[model samples]
Target: MIVTPPSAEEVTGHAASMYDRDTQDDGFVFAHTQVMAINPEAHEAFESLVKAIVASIGIGVYEAATLGAARAIGSAHCLLAHGRKALRAGVLDDDGLRAFAHHDDSGFSESEQAVVRFAERLSADAASMTDADSQALRDVGFTDRQIVDITLAAAARNFFSRALLALDVPVDVVPGVSPKTAAALTARVR
Candidate 1:
């Protein structure tokens, strides 16, 4: 990482709390969390927004959108992290995640495919997005609120992914993700 993260002993207040939460949840502090915790307020706010979006839209849908945006942005970090989340949420199996990383939408439902396409377009070229982009979501039976949450999920991934890339943060070796799946997820990153 270009920036040095605070040592565990140096972390205090909200940052310390974040470290504790990560340890409790994931059994370790994620490098991303450690780096982002450098600005605890911003990190907390961003995490809260992500939690809200996930709560509003189901984890399955959020992971689909996030994976799409991550692929579009060529973020190996997001792809691996969200791929593990998708697996844990029962949204995708190992084969399904591999297919997604390879840009094959065959394993996904029509609604999920639509969400992925929409997120890919938004992340890759938001400037060219039109009303039709949102219309696609409606066609797939997404309500306005669900659509908004999906947008938030994708946009938020872009923000966090870009920050990691900008800072040259090393991608975490996400536990529970298979090596084959990890290679597929990172294929585009190189």
Candidate 2:
């Protein structure tokens, strides 16, 4: 069973305010934020980190990397969340976004394919990454800054996956997913 994190009402001070803002923004509090709310400072730091990362890479690339890593790790919650973000950013449609798990067969552009592969590789075994991997990204016209952003995006997704998985959070915790999208992810995970 999942360990229930403190609810918005259970928190006080900054955490409580953040929770209120999250509810206001989305009409429901996110489970990820709820988990982070246990330590308000950490939750704030996480939000700040996400902001810096998103600024470094455009939302499209960041969300793409996130989808790739989340898919590789089989985190259905992230897959749906980032998949939606990618769709909204016009990076891909739902079908195209879902195809990221096997991007080689998905008809994505060469650079997009490279980013997907990088995220998959990073999720699978980051320590095994070598100069050739970085070189491949450069070969695809990614600047060093963009490459770093991709790496950070993939790494951050893995960090979140590990934490959420360890906590036994249910995949349904993802908010605003359509039934079709949720079914697709559930089918994929199974």
Candidate 3:
């Protein structure tokens, strides 16, 4: 990483809490967690927003949107992390995740495919987005609130993934991810 994060012993308040939470959940501190802990308040706020988005749109859609944004942004980190999250949430099987990472929407429902396309467009070129982009989601029966939540999820992933990339944070070896799945997730990263 371009900047060294605080040591576990050196953190306090939210940083310490984040470290502890990562240890409890994943058995170690993630590189992204440690890096983000450098600004604990921002990290906490971002995480809270993500949680709210997931609660609003549901994990399956959140993961689909996240994966699409990650793939469009060439963020191996988000792809692997959220791909594992999708698996744990029962949103996708291993092969389905691999196919999704490769830009195949065949495994997804119509609504999910719309979400993915929307997220990819938003992440790749938000300035070019038109109202029709959102109308597509509406046509798929997504409420305005759900569309907003999906937008937030994709935008949040772009922010977090860009930060990690800028800082040169190494991708964590997500637990329970198969080797092939990991390879697929990172296939587009250079």
Q: Which candidate leads the pack in TM-score?
A: 3
Residues 10-48 of candidate 3 have per-residue lDDT tens digits of 999999999998899889999989999999999989989
Model 1, 1-190: lDDT tens digits are 7798998899998999989987887798888888988999998899899889988678888988999999999998899988998898889999999988888976678999999999999899999999899999999899999999999999999999999989888887888899999998997793
Error of 3 at 125 (Å): 1.0
lDDT of each: 0.90, 0.75, 0.90
Task: Give Cα distance to truth, residue 8, candidate 1, Å.
Answer: 1.0
lDDT of 2 by residue, 65-109 (tens): 787788788887688777766766777776665555444426356
Backbone collision count in every prediction? Answer: 0, 0, 0
Error of 2 at 113 (Å): 2.1
Q: Rank the candidates by lDDT, best first.
A: 3, 1, 2
lDDT at position 97, candidate 3: 88
Best by lDDT: 3
Residue pairs of candidate 1 with colliding backbone atoms: none
Model 2 segments more than 4 A misplaced:
101-109, 173-176
Q: Tally clashes: model 1.
A: 0
TM-score, predicted candidate 2 vs. hidden true structure:
0.85
List ranges where model 3 is wrong by over 4 Å: none
Better of 2 and 3 by lDDT: 3
